[model samples]
Target: MNLPSLRATERFANQMILDACRGAKRVHIVDYGILYGDQWPSLIKALSERAEGPPLLKITGIDFPSLVNLEKTGNRLVDYAKSCGMHLEFHSIATAAWESAQPRYHLFSELLFVNCQLRMRHIREDGIIDSPRKLFLEKILSFKPVMFFQSVVHADIGSPFFIHRFDGAWRSFLARLESFEETMKLELIDQSQLDFMDKFIEKCAMGAIACDGQNRVERISSYKTWDRLARKGQFGQLPVSKRALEMVMSVWSGHENFTYGMDENWLLLGWKDVVLNALSVWEPIEKLPRFKHQ
Candidate 1:
């Protein structure tokens, strides 16, 4: 099933990334939580079809060490780029924590973009000087990417109290399940596929409720919280372009239950009344010196 919110996020993100890299000779993308590398194939195709010819592309995918085989993911992306006749390089960084992962900065030249999708919340947000999320954001800012795009599930499911967290998770899960059910009803789906989706959602619900302390993975925060965090980190929010907004609207044009809107500079996607996800773009607050790779 094509999840409307996910598809909309991908479409909006790719459009922005393409626009940022237009006319650049070399482009580097640092992707956080690049599971399966599903978002890059369409981007590679778009680059290949560029009128001025595709730029040399380099992607550095960062994720937990045990979560995925980085080498395999890199190979798959490399092979896909080759098929498109685009020169590409893929680097994989596997670390226990995002704050500790150090990417090769010397390789970045010309255009640099960072893509963080539904993953930052996984970094422990304990109120401490060594907060992983803060350090991670600082690291990204240090890279001085032209544009930093973040898509996060906006839910108050990361509260410290179990009862509050459980209540938030339950409500968010129900909303997501309802949206999935409505979508499935519109599309002709077989029982086997239905069973698979059921399992998938159930697993996510269990993870959100039963786990805690480093073990709990789905630590989602509200968009307001993210907004404060980004501003506190000395990043300036960028407005979503008119074309990008229209493109996202077209993705959900036929789905009456789906809704889209903007909160400040962030673009939001929702199912009915419950806001599910948010996409925000940012750049460094102070201009930094640009260095090309030697």
Candidate 2:
């Protein structure tokens, strides 16, 4: 997500962390799927800018080794921390699933935060938790985070909840793509830019649509389902205030294209109104392996 889209998320996350850490000297945040490091600068800057913030902000990033360059990303974060006057220590653990990986306890503090964004869907793509996904969540909750900041692209195609709305959503995405294409044509965009847009349309816009015989299903579930999984794993949603929601939506309110909607407890965002289904995958309950919260 872009910085504007994530402004409210960062605020909510920082508030939760501060509230949870109340009297703590330090805060430890565990970030899952730290892809290319676009998500952190704003959050880190916000926390450091907080006058009442903890003395130390330690973040542990977890992802597959082959997918991320740990040392390189860690160095970039360390540099930002140093400039911001926060005692920043970053540790990168190479693991595909948290269930199988181990995080050194010495890095943790009294307050723990788990950050997951747009990446958990892959874990439930098969409609089952299987072993790794369950274990991954189980291990994180083992740290007993004060709050888990999870931002899934909600698109619950599994339920009739969005049955009637799917068409509108599809149209919106298509319109956005068409508008962009027209703009490109007007500007006579280069071949590379055209290529990028093609990829975005294929992977993002089109990939979100689920029809018969299509392998790319919108695996995102509703907030209710997520609540069930969170409850199973021993975490709960952070209650967000009305003002906060408005503030988050305020940035996009005047925008002509992008749309946002609310359902159950999920606040959905997209290029248009096509969020009838959750964008992430769901896990099948019957197939979930027994996991007693650690």
Candidate 3:
């Protein structure tokens, strides 16, 4: 959640989305499923220096509060917004609250269901609950934000969790993209610009790659979840670090047969389109695009 550099690749896509809507007087940033506002300071810092007309930023971060971490990061952002002179607001809504407030406040979800981790729990209680899926899609189609950008987990479609539904394979998982595309039904704006897989490959090939003694890298990925990768060892293998390994352990810990291509393995799936938006494929980050004000 702590993107060391506010302008780096890991955080670039989300930043680009906000930057695209920079001219709006009241920018409603809806962070529903995942709430990590620690990223706000870096964003506010980056935005304050922009040459465009400064919009009176009205920020709203929505979330399933009980399920996620909101306090620390939210407090930090509230403070940052006040300091930057941006009009601020926060809406912490849960599913039950959403049901009651559906009369007025908009209820929306910009997610592909496989990512929700809600497929099973609902079915257990209702014995065959398809209503929420429709609700999920309905909210999205209805809200139709001015500038919409979201990451839907599309790997291993029909995951073991939904084996009966997705059939479970990388191809099956990616196939959902088409169904999702047909669902939300947005203005097809190809806004991709970062070659994450190629960059990872290049980073792995170059001396930029780093690894631990056992050749494993301890990675705390986007969800702040812990991952342990270790190389071949004397009887078995040993983790490089008890917690998180540094850069040295990352190089060799990467997938050896990692094929960085145009296919699904690519981290930033829409990099090609975004780069097309920038009108050129850049080395890492896409050069900023000029978004028209609404």
Candidate 4:
């Protein structure tokens, strides 16, 4: 099974809520697509362990009805809650967001990571899921917590970022929430935060070494800026995760611009910005496993 994300929207949101659990009697978590609900247990553990608390904890996990691993994921969520001494309940929707969407609140931890959404790009207008997410928040603004953590993608491999272009579907989704009369304090993720997978960086360095003794090293970038390989010591000294960037770069080659270099979180609809960031890959890692080669 894949490990949960330390940098995921869920985990990040929890981090923001680690404090200020006062008056919070319950927590709500919405997994629009509950892929095994695998992240919930760890998140619960983190919440249970991270901050000092009072007032019993109640966690409600809501998911799409058709998930195959619903039973397993729900069981894990329950077990984790019991072990952590938190109250737990599970709810599911037989329909999809496409079919219909209902505002959901699942848990009440000190950490608040609400605007968790998949992203997409539209040419005529911008598509920001957070826009609708704000609506969701407006509905719950009365219970206003301290911090809200959100993660969104600014770049992707193709013309549309939604894994495919979304036809104002996001705007339509957000429109559903706009009827709320109030709004909550909001913040967006800056560009510098999520730039690379440690593994992707390592792969880049590996590819550099594999490139040859004389190949010219062009640029190195993570999620932000791109720079050229410094010297003989640069790639060789980078950690395996850093070198893994080479593979991600290779993958970027297929993209209009390596979004990783352009700062993986930058809005990608502009014409002027093409190449993302440059990841310096030519170094060597000692005894590191090699990523797939091109």
Candidate 5:
């Protein structure tokens, strides 16, 4: 998909990953929902051109077993890495649930990075005592990655209440439609492309409004809710790096409607007033020692 917001978010994330892996000899990246592995080629190219040479890169792609062809994706990446003359290892973990793949992640001494882009919201948030969302976050935290990067759409459509969810989903659907319209006006979008965008937005709207319980796949939450969840899971937010900011701006130089800003530590990318996506970096907080009670 050539959506401006999606492209912008991916670019921003690639920059952050490149910056984070600056001096590492061996780097391991765990990518959630690594659909077609589109984000890595640029990072691979940059890493290969590094002054000290590219690190021994290992990427573990996790996704639903039925949704992706892991072997095909890995082969493509391996071929691309070979073309760049960079040594790379690709691992694939296919599972129905995110937390279930925890034991399968092959951790090594490499500096670790976890990338979750528009994927976490799909994990059900219904369980009061032990929600899947919380378990997934805890699993990521357990990895103790050097950097954890995530990008999510900022909306309140995840609410369980039908009325509230409908309101949020309606507004979100409109904002996305408006963005596409505005983008088409500024740039030349073909009829087919426009139709595809419409279908994508429609799917999301239907999922949010039509489906209920586990059936609702498009469960989006606000950035604030994500922040609370991350903190509760003992993760500390990191400020957006200046280099990442510059890279995003440079990519978006010509587009006036697409804007980027920082909300505390988050890097917010929006179309006009409606924030479409929010990207943030996080790290596991160290456990404090407890003195014996006297």
Candidate 6:
């Protein structure tokens, strides 16, 4: 997460989360793919540190059954939050597929936030009603979060055909960067950074020539498709102001090698089309359910 672009994305999301829980006693955040659980500490700190903010914060981190240590991670976070005088009800839920887990909506209350970062790529699985995209809409509409935050990688590669054919300008740009040895110098980059850059190049090259048309693992669609889905789900997009975009880009301001962009939907993506990370916050078109008032 040392990548400036990535750090910017996380910062953007953190602000959005804070805004959503501005003045509340309780907040529940459902993180679809809680990968490494790295983003929560900062968020927890923010909530606890806020002088006048939500009094209680509850996070329900959900992921596939493969994340064996999820509860252990959640407990650690819980302990950390408690030490800081914040009540963090951390729960780790393991399920086969989050889309199919829509029936689990009863687990969360109305003061909720849905954080779906880089997890949309797995939302489609070859069916009509059971499609990942359809289920994603259904999942959010179920609880109708006060705020919805989503960020995806290479969101423009919606289809294998599009992945096969890169824009003329983009292809040339990648070619130029790949040949530049400066990016791989140990003094300038770490093994992790080198690994990320190498794999990204390999994916683009392989995607261009690989004959298997239906094997795209991260089946992602463009932001346009996501916009359409959001509207269909009766959600309204909140603009990420110029100031926010500027903040997101601030990290890369002096870095000459990186390029940053904000799509029409105000989603942020970096490094041309290769490393796409768009972030958008949405509010429910209608009031969502809340726990019964005393």
Residue-level lDDT of model 5, residues 1-294, one tens digit each, is 565676677787888878767777778889999978988898999999999988988899988888899899999999999999998899998886887676334345567788888787777888867888898888888887777887888888776788988888777779889888777756787888888888988998888778988788878899989999999999999888788887777756555777767889988877767787888988889622211100
**Candidate 2 residues 1-294, lDDT tens each?**
233444545554555554445445666778787756666776677667666664576778887777779778888988987788777888888775556666555323335667776566545334355655566677766665556677764544433334543653456446546545654655568778867876775665444454423354434454456666766876544455565565566654544655666655556666554542221211222221212211
- Candidate 5 deviant stretches above 4 angstroms: 103-108, 184-187, 287-294
lDDT against the true structure, per candidate, is 0.82, 0.58, 0.31, 0.34, 0.81, 0.65
Candidate 1: RMSD to truth: 2.2
Cα lDDT tens digits, model 6, 241-263, are 56566667766554455565556
Clashes of 5: 0
Q: Which stretches of model 1 miss by more than 4 angstroms?
A: 289-294
lDDT: the better of candidates 3 and 6:
6
Scanning candidate 4 in windows of ten residues, the lowest lDDT window is 178-187
The digit string of per-residue lDDT tens for model 1 on 120-197 reads: 777778767878888888888888888888888888876778888788877778888887777776776677777787
* Candidate 1 C-alpha error for residue 198, in Å: 2.4
Q: Largest lDDT belongs to which candidate?
A: 1
Model 4 has a clash total of: 46
Candidate 5 at residue 9, lDDT? 71
Model 4 alpha-carbon miss at residue 93, Å: 2.6
RMSD of each: 2.2, 7.1, 18.4, 20.4, 4.7, 4.3
Sequence-dependent TM-score of model 5? 0.92
Where does model 4 exceed 4 Å of error?
A: 1-8, 20-23, 50-55, 60-62, 69-71, 103-149, 156-294
TM-score of 2: 0.70
Return whichever of 3 and 5 wins on TM-score. 5
lDDT of 4 by residue, 16-79 (tens): 3433333354555544445566546665775666445433443333344554556676777778
Error of 4 at 239 (Å): 29
Q: What's the residue-level lDDT of 88 in candidate 1?
A: 85
